[model samples]
Target: MKKQLGDSNILRNWIKGFEYCEIGFNKPPNSLVYLACTSTGRVSNLRIQNLDFYAPFPNAICSLTELNSLEIYNWTGLHGQIPSCISKLVNLRSLVITKTSISGSLPSFSKNTNLIGITLSNNHLSGTIPPSLSTLPNLHLLDLSSNYLCGEIPKGGNMGQFNAANFANNTCLCGNPLPTCFNSAHTSAPAPAPVSTTMFDSAPVPAPVSITIFESTPAPEMAPDSNSEFLSPRDLDTEILLLQMKKQLGDPGFLGNWVIDAICGFTELEYLEIYHLPGLHGLIPSCISKLVNLQILLITNTSLSGSVPGFSNNTNLNVIFLRNNHLNGTIPPSLSTLPPNLSSLDLSSNYLCGEIPQGGNMWKFNAANFANNACLCGNPLPPCFNLAPAPSP
Candidate 1:
């Protein structure tokens, strides 16, 4: 029994080989000293920082099952995968390994439900973030940024609390708080063909075209041979939508570089996302509903206000994220009628109010989907109440 209390000696032996790491007893004022044990003599916390060492992550440390927090910071020479055995530390409440040369996939922490924070930034970790991590109910702070991770971020549990910056610089991380992921079928599309006089000379002219140039760009001088047959009906619709969007959004300067013709050329666009643009303000133009082929619509972290636009015409829309905005007014009841393929929806962190439209695909979402609104009420949320009529007055 006396040998079991000697866990501190075991910890010392594990890190003794690392150059410049000062092994110490309990918490001290010095930053180099990195050990702290519980009253029972169990090693409860280990913080190793700024140590100059070239070694694979020490797997021996995972033996300390009593550890409550494990932090390894700025060890640029530390490499290899985070040891999977570390998950055996069921008491671990925080696991932070940042600014390291660690490579390989993130380990599963499904058993570590006590975890409150995880910061694995600035590493070479690859592959998708495991869906099991999102099931950690107490996990509120997470930073997996600056890694080679990809695929849709799991949306269950507390993931909605995090924003894009937490997952920034990952190769292709998507879903809520980031852009929607594109399926292989919708990966790439051809750019719109440039306008030419000979385009209509060979094909039958479909319709008369009208063009509106924004003040940001100088209007092109009409050539002597230029005619009204320059654009097709599809092109005209896209141009009109862009114009409506520009006018409604106050013509923010960030959009100055968007080539109108090139954007209009994506006649088969399946996904449309506008994210993290604080300068983007005003109501979502209702004209956006005209995009019948759009399967995902995400416009978040902007200053856009006004009611949620009706998407009755967008039957193909499978995902809709309009969170973290200034939007207000009741969720349009028409949304309740969207097809069953409308699987994902989030309107949280906005100024929205009134009963959430119930029925159809809306039943699939829970309180998290409509959370942080001004005064939303209904099933999934608390039931709405009726006001009593005034008495004799």
Candidate 2:
């Protein structure tokens, strides 16, 4: 009296019965294609890529409650919102759906505590990114780039470690690892208290009349305090640096109490390291190149853009790690001429292009140092085709 296929076989049957698209596998025992099941016959992983099919998100896939990883890529015809029922897959860890026509706001995955990575880039997704995403404790890799997401980026948790490229091409999105939000009302902190005009007004004066009429009076100008001390050149420079950072980085909480003297104390700084600071956006401060005594310059995992600063002045520099940033433009040719003291360099994961300069310490590093760039070529990387000799007659 028992059914032919028991409850444990339900996920397997769903996979076989699925006909919305032609599923193919790499070296299939055809029956087990496109999916991997747990010993209990529950589907645990599903990956479908490059299939030409026109269909909405396959909601039936959500029924595989044990599913831990779901990846669908380059399905140009795949459309519709990622079904909310996906949250039902409590074991879901990694969800990647790229190069599709999927459109919708990212759904909340509050129940999926084990979730680690979520990449939904290169799609038609629109709407503000949910702030709750920042609260995911185990979440690390998040790439929502090339979509239409907008609004301020959330601040806490591991969000500060993600690369700027992860959020690139979303024109409307603003805040850390991207540009600062100009709209004051949307900022995370409360707006500054309005200035009191009454404090600047002169005391009310009675006019010479039967009725007590008030007369307009001019406020007296205040004199500068004689006890105020003049700031030295070093102190002034520190203040300027602090203000520049504040203007560019949008005043993160850790920097709220930073005073000019705190930075002035580091006048002889030899190794300056700035990492895991997501709010650290904007160009590499040209003044950094002026640190003649600096032996190491490490600024990684931020949204720093523009060309790499000229480090010719830092003759003592031995290590430079500017990886995982939004830096564009060609590597400074001068870097190849740096003194032999320069032994380590890492400019990977940036938008840098053009040929890798030869000579000097450039020969010391390998391909890994210059990997993941926009159009980098030469020695350490695949040679630039443009540099190839003309095909003879």
What are the per-residue Cα lDDT tens digits for candidate 2 across 113-213? 65656778788777677777887765645788887777788788757756678888764778887888887233222211100000000111122111000
Q: Judged by lDDT, which candidate is best? A: 1
Roughly what TM-score does model 1 have, to 2 decimal places?
A: 0.43
Clashing pairs in 2: none
lDDT of 1 by residue, 1-25 (tens): 1122233332354443443222343
Question: What is residue 91's positional error in candidate 1, in angstroms?
Answer: 0.3
Quality of model 2 by C-alpha lDDT: 0.62
Give per-candidate clash totals.
0, 0
Model 2: residues with Cα > 4 Å off, grouped in runs: 1-33, 184-393
Model 1 CA deviation exceeding 4 Å by range: 1-33, 184-393
Each model's lDDT comes to 0.64, 0.62
